[model samples]
Target: MKLQTLALFCAVSLLLFSGCGGISPKPSDETKIDKTLPIVKLTQNGVVEDMNSIAFEWNAITDERVKGIYVYKQRNNLEGSELRHYKTLENRFTTHFLDNDVIPNTSYTYSFKTFSKNAESQMSEMKIVSSLPVLQSVVWIKSIENMPRAAKIIWRPHANQKVKSYIIERKTLEEESWKRIATIDGRLNAEYIDTGLKDDYVYKYRVKVVTFDNITSTPSEIVQVVTKPLPNPVKHIVATTDLPRKIEINWEKSEAKDFARYHLYRSTSSNGSYELIAKLYNPTFTDIVEEDAKEYFYRVSVVEKNGLESIHNKISIQGITLMKPQTPSLLEAKLVNNKIEINWKNKDSRVVKYSVVKKSKTGWFDAKEEEFVDIKGLKFTDPEIGPNTTYYYKVYAIDAYGIKSKPSIEVQVKTPAGVRDNSKKEEITQDKPSRPVNKEVEVIVPTQDFN
Candidate 1:
């Protein structure tokens, strides 16, 4: 029981001395000073300063008992601030120290102490120093705004010889934060081209220089630029609807100085996807469909020399090929006096001529058909037909443009049987009893109409 109680008491004492959870407290400033030990002395002219760094040098110590030295620093801007342990030089003969963690245009107070195994000398007389002012950025910057879908930035290279590279930053007008866009490697490279940018958009840019020691200077002046817009669309487009087997499209020529060509698009319907059919410098185009009564839609756009195209026009023009002539109407068909006759009426005012198509059945499985073209009259008589044979006939009209219409309704007719030859033979009579008299027969057949 006594051993356990002792162990508990030791554990509580350890926690109390180590400030709970086995963590040590922060070290306090040194109060005990050994006046007999030698203190560090600073050189008369051993301080060098720059915008981002400070270097200090001191007289070397020859004391064998001195093991190392401790350096402490305090910011001058903070009120009632104590010196904080910054670094330690483990060798007694070390005479130089560099502080690069300090910022520009800031003052700091520093002190040093010489220490042995168990004792430290008094703090040396404090030294106050300041870093130089911040470095300036490049002077001249220019931006080219008229490039298509891109922007070019140019500037005079930084005059400082310590510069290593340049950092380019950009921001749009709607954004409040600047974004790092590029890092140029060479100090003498004075041009940067930013591509794949939005057209007709405004952007802001600035340049920052990095030194050889990796110190970034202040940003240069901001420059604003706008990318070039797209080319203008073609205007006053017209399409012909009355031409046969072809469509003619015409538009006003582009007036832009950078115009390169025109794009022609075609589609079957107004809402269908338009396909690019042609690219040319001429303002007129001919589309030959080689079919009658066909319709199509079209759109045109202009392209610039940089291959930037204008927006597609929402309105499309409709074009159509010429239609064929109206069909002819059959009026009458009849077989009269060993002949077949067909009559038709022209329904279209554009019809200039007519044609008759005749079909005759010559045998049980064989038939013959013929078309009589360029007939000036509406009625046709076919005398070349065989007797007692059925004949079919149809009529069609033709226009001045050589376009034929649909055939008329079919008409059929059968010719009557031809007259049979019959003559009686007279018995031979002697002397002057009788002379052979010839008998003449005439048969009249009425007209047979098959409508």
Candidate 2:
């Protein structure tokens, strides 16, 4: 009976040992793998490369147990794109990745997860990203003047971070190759002015952008601009003041299709202020100024149809008005000692000379010889007339400009029949006269002082 109790105790002890071996020990919290994803920092924002390529970057993960990284992307409905897994990275130290397969005008969402030795962490925060749209063509290019010789080029700016500078290029219709005109920073000016250009020319322009990574963008749309032909200036302006109180201005017309009208300017002095006096379609203008014996200035300019005015060509002239010398009167003719003598009353002291003309009784008026005397004397003697012959005499006065005055009343006289030519008489003639005769003499001769 003692041997049986021992066997049962042994069997109970063995069963207890077996049940203890079947039970498992609980694990400690220190050995458990984390299920949360690593918090990431954006190292670089989403940026465009080339035209359609994109690149993104982030901070490295800090978890000691992180074995690999998984990058996931989704197409955002806001961007009109589809959702899909973009990439899975086996390297946990990788901080950046490139997305070459990107469409323009489409948006994307990115998320990353960390995988430990036992478990996968939760996905990190989703990152919204997109590439910039392609560079578009220019909208329009034009000139500001009606007769254009310069152009202004304009374009829209790109909104991407990679864009650094803009390049402007041009090609004229006469040239075969393209030429770069300007390069501007995208952060500053957006428009360009091309001046000193030829008129009536056709030009084409284009633009491009450069990124920080030294990548060039596609060229913008081409714009074609045609310039208008410039009009020529008015030529040969002349001013004349020949009338009593009027000034006449004349200029050659500009033979241009864009010729609209003309403008006339007047000034008292050559270098003084000028005022607009008249607007005319014709090239000739007559100004009725009341002032006399004064100098006047004038200018003329042509206006184009586009409102551009040509350069002014100016002219100046002086006008004068002087009184004429008075006529002489009281003409008388008489016969003395077979010679004829003629006299006239000198009423005008300004008269420089006097003229005497005589004709036979039945002779035509054209067959008469005229004699002249200076201010020295008012009387003349003729000895070549035959005695008892009928003759007629007249007198006139002359001015400085060789203008003649009215004639005096005609007188008739008769000479004695015994008279001969003056050359035959010895007493009335001298070999050499005291002063030059029958010519213009400007000497101050001795005269009887009436005072």
Candidate 3:
């Protein structure tokens, strides 16, 4: 009996020691969700009414074995695919999400996953979860003008996400807030048309999650827009030039990246308002003034691509048409009959003007500038010559820029004993008109002549 008791005691000792092999087991009271928020139970709250106020609901808990819960989102269908592991917090119940800031015209599929600090519980039935958030579509706030209450907001379904609805919101820029605008149907949709707006006011727009609960998650980033009528722009301005038969216009070229064509303006007077002369595809423009006005002013303006024009730039200059003079060496005439006929001719008129003057015993006085002064045709005749008297004559030419030259050698003539002079008459050999005998003038803006 002593041996038997001894054997039984040894067996019990072995059994007790085998049972107490490793470390102590952790208690079940404490819960910890670490890397993932496991989907122990998924609850779908059904379809939403107002897309703007739509929302998704879920219940959460960190496994009792984990230290903290790590929340993650699977952008694709919440299938057992990959998840963009995002936020992690100690608490685990905040599983609701708002579909804001998503690209317009696209859908987003969202799902929740739970991670345990124990690492033994794999991604908790993410694919197996019965409930998930189906973001119908994201909408872009349409820009509006001249209406406070009414607006036209638009959006698109999330491309890569599974969308089931759309939500939009609006508020005045002055209010510093937003209100629900319209609820877009996910199945039957294109654009959300909101009408009946105030006359002139500012408005802000945003979007929200569209699900069962009106639990609007968070406001979308506001798309700023304005609604006011545009003011009128100044009218057309004209361009003209100082040179006869010439046009010149100047304008400021816009540094705007969206630059467009330019316009030229013309006006009869410097002070007078201008009129649009023509449209130039370039910044600077030139046109011929056919009428050859005595004076002209010009204006240039910028034209935007959107058909908007800026104020005109104005400038004016004096206009003159100059005819150069010729050099006449021998000029003489005397009274032959009751008619006082006179004749004159010149050398070259290299872009110059000529003035002819006469005197009655006293020295010469100023006379009128001539039109027939060029080297091409330098002759003029006043066909009324009267009888017997002495006449003195001299001539010279001026340049294109209106610089007068010195007088030519003078000649004295007498028409006496009229009938006998017929035998001694000399043939009038007219030379191809010669150019002006120019004096070397110092040029202010000198240029080198190749010749």
Candidate 4:
């Protein structure tokens, strides 16, 4: 009994020594059950930056024991149990991650979990991420002018992907197949210049982008352009005076490409100032002259569909209006047997006919009294003259060109003092002749007011 009491005392003394030594005690059951992990808030959503690539961001975890974040990805069509392990990050202080391996044009679901040395917490709120497909095509392709026989193609850079090169294709109006003309590196500006093209021909173009993985994108929208052609001057230009008081101009139609119209220019002299007279869809023009026997110069130029005019300084021609015949001369008037006889002499053989005009004393010259007289031996007999009154007469000649001649010198005559009795004077005819008087009365026809 004494030994058992000694053992009890020793046990009590050991407990007091252990209490004086300040030894740590075992954790309680409540402390052992608490296994809470870090809670993180998503600062930014997942965003696609390239083909099969996305970036993610989150707030820094507040738990000191958090080792890192664990990322999990799953197809959007699958349930939460189908999530696959994507990546694991060991950096406890890091709050972002970039996932590079994924399928393009597909949707994926993602979540993050905080892990410790001995335990893994429940994942943060689920997030959805999607990786988009590569760019389909470039944008805004167009053709700019480089030369008459060349074409310049330009386009905007592709978006949402990395491009390695560009391919340019062309096709003519009559062709249905496309031909690759150039390969431009993506590092340079999105442009290409194609040379040695046929003039006046229509062409179509399209562009395609190639990725770094050697995948080609869909072709761009089609663009159309027509090359300009050199101007072709008109041939065989002619000018003639076939009409009265006008000049007719003509030229051979140009057979060159893009023939639009013709331009006719006129000038009074060959080296003088030129004026545009007419623009004709046809090849002919008529210039109406204002004065008689005037000279005019003419030239023709070809206008192309592109508004280019051919050079015409080396070609020119001249034309003149029809010439008018001279007037008759030596007009004579005499009173015979109460009738007046008029006669004139024409020096030009071109004169085909003659006209006579008369006026009584103290009477205005009436246009109605003008008469076209047949030039029978160049003489005319006037049976309507009055007695004891004087009359003035003038004459003109008509030429073969339908042109009128100048007025002839005037002539004056008076009948006998007695009235002309119609009963006594039978109508004078060409079969009979009238006796002439010796007295000659004369007046001059003023040409200043002649039409």
Candidate 5:
């Protein structure tokens, strides 16, 4: 309590009792009332404070009757049972309640019942008071200061909790796991700095406070963003065989703004000795898997366009998903007069685009992977292979995440020497193309908006 409060209390007490002189009011056994109930009044029915304390004041009862008054409190104003039935009031006109212990933004109900030997004033209408406690507002500052390798975090103090303690909580975006960052005791001095990160990039942060009865306040707004201006995701990347020779990897971008390009790292093993593979423009990268028929790992690092790596942390390898890219199935390879027509039913929607790689002395090489973009939903016809050469064919599927899958079960296609030399061409020509149904073709197509 402030010093002025004690002085004020003494002065008020002196003034109230001074009017009573040396004689104390006598309590009568009989009730004094013209009606069935004694008259009771209030000087103030409600109060608003800084969640510190309230001086409840009411009109003193008269009629030369009334032995005592009982005060009550209710946390829920709907009110039947008072949280506390009672504290005996020492005065008729006023009682003081310490509100600093109450939660901010909560409503409380208080009332008094005065009694005499034969009658009790009907409980004075409950007074509802609300306080705007010194609750805080959390402000996110410089982000996770130490990033990735050493997740460091920094933020400004809550504006309202100058008289309370503060604590921080964190979790990885990849899992439902959450843990305490730290606790600061003694009416926090304002700012909090967090460190010790396990992932290459740090992603989540929140703040909270504790109050009377150890009741913790609701957490502050969630402020999530990359801790450093570096490529954060440097782990959990996978090599795909779909675009053969080239592997695809992808990860989520930071929730915060102010970032540009991710750094892609390639390692022969999951544990590092990594080399900067590529400076990615997006959360994805496509590169030669490096070694064929061998497994490897990759990760992305969050890098600011300004060239700052967030505290040496990168998105951990654990951040990567292991789901292999799917390979389209039921492939049909046919010869058509020096040209090879490849078709398949897309059982896998991940087939963002299909690549036809041909095996040569140099190893399996893309026949038309670079020429196609977003050709995921299609069939391909290639005449680029030299005639009379039998070529082993493989189909690869890509996904929105850039993770590539293993090359579909390898198949074979051979181009005939000439139009007559292609037996499959002759067989195909014998069958006519299917025509559209009449009713289905008659449907109208609208190219413009209804408006």
Candidate 6:
């Protein structure tokens, strides 16, 4: 009797372990044909409300031997279709099952069975069901082109209230794959502005709806846009080479509707770095330099009101200040008969007049004094000379436009000591002879050029 009790206890323990804590063995094809087990019948047809989920209802099980229900599904439309175990309802009281793994727009065959510790029932009558199609994207989309460094996309809000957000995607014309740029929250948000984009580039965009379940809808119609290009370069640029101590630049006024100003750049060489010199609304500019005959390279660009600047003109223009008159050449400077005489030759035909600059020392400790004398002739004579004093002289040529040439090489001369001026009359006394008295006088002329 004790042995019988031990065997019964072992059998009950095996049943309890197999029914509760153990993984149920999948029914083989031979076992699936067995009809000894009770079958679970569907109470109603399967229902599908969305693309990815389906709802199923079945009659409650009344058999005391039944442990659970097994759900099997098959894609009927696919080749080599076969029934596969999909899910298991461990509780006998579960009359409803939600199948969320079904594909959108696909037909599936479903079967149900009741399973116990030792056997599974024959498969129930197969039900043909399909999930609804994927949610459609927004119907209308528009793109605003020609925006500065940005693109704007606008679309009509999704008609379905289930949509919770929008997914924005973009691609350039040169790209093959699309990129998700932004996710805008709220069904009513209908516009997105994509910034920091390339200028003058073409881009494609599409919109998708995201439901509250996080399932993405199909992409909307593709829309193309082009960012605004830079303004056109300034045309007909010209630079003056004959202006005195200045260079004048001129160009044709921009005809673009967005024209804001002109930017002028200057460089010392054609290929060197250019520095912005001026920004002006007018098309003309003047650059004043410190020296004449100065040359510079120039380029011009047009600026738009949006702060976009056109490319620099590929070919740089050359400009120059007016050339100075030729320097005068000093011919002679000597002290003759108590006076300093200076002479020079004009080498430039543009020279209309000349100037003589005389530099002399006032005293041993005093600063040097300079005197300028203007003359129409080539020679100049200084009559206000001091005896035994040294003098330096330079000659300059002046043009009709008041442009002065560089000073000539300097010359030096020294007057004789105790020299009497011939221009003064001497009074003769009884002690002095009326005859003219002549004394030897030494005149000093520069042997080398001062400068």
How accurate locally, in lDDT, is each candidate?
0.80, 0.64, 0.45, 0.72, 0.55, 0.80
Order the candidates by TM-score, highest first: 6, 1, 4, 2, 5, 3
Report the C-alpha lDDT of model 3 over 277-381, residue by residue, as the tens digit. Answer: 787776566565454333556655556554445545434433332222344544333233222223344446353445444322312452222222433234323
Residue-by-residue lDDT tens digits, candidate 4, 143-186: 87524677888898777456888989999878879999888986
Better of 2 and 3 by TM-score: 2
lDDT of candidate 2 at residue 339, scale 0 to 100 = 52
Deviation from truth (RMSD, Å), model 5:
24.9
| TM, every model | 0.80, 0.37, 0.33, 0.44, 0.37, 0.83
Error of 5 at 214 (Å): 5.5
Q: Candidate 5 at 374: error in angstroms?
A: 74
Which residue ranges in model 1 land beyond 4 Å of their true spot? Answer: 1-31, 78-81, 132-134, 416-451
RMSD of each: 10.1, 22.2, 18.9, 18.6, 24.9, 7.1
Error of 5 at 366 (Å): 79
- In model 6, the number of clashes is 0
After superposition, candidate 2 runs with Cα above 4 Å error: 1-204, 209-216, 220-230, 313-451
Model with the higher lDDT, candidate 2 or 3: 2
TM-score for predicted model 3 compared with the true structure: 0.33
| lDDT score at residue 336, model 1, on the 0-100 scale | 44
lDDT digits (tens) for residues 1-451 of candidate 5: 6889999999999988987775433324364432544444555553545544554655655545666666667776554745454455545544343444565666777776676556666667777777664455355544544443444445565555343676767877885966787887765455555544443464677777765435465677776655543344344444454444455666665543547766666676667777786876666765654443445566566666445554333433422223555666634666543445555555565556656565522234533332333444445555455545556656666776555666666656544444234322332211123333332111112233111
Which tens-of-lDDT digit does each residue in 170-195 have in candidate 2?
89877898899988886344677777
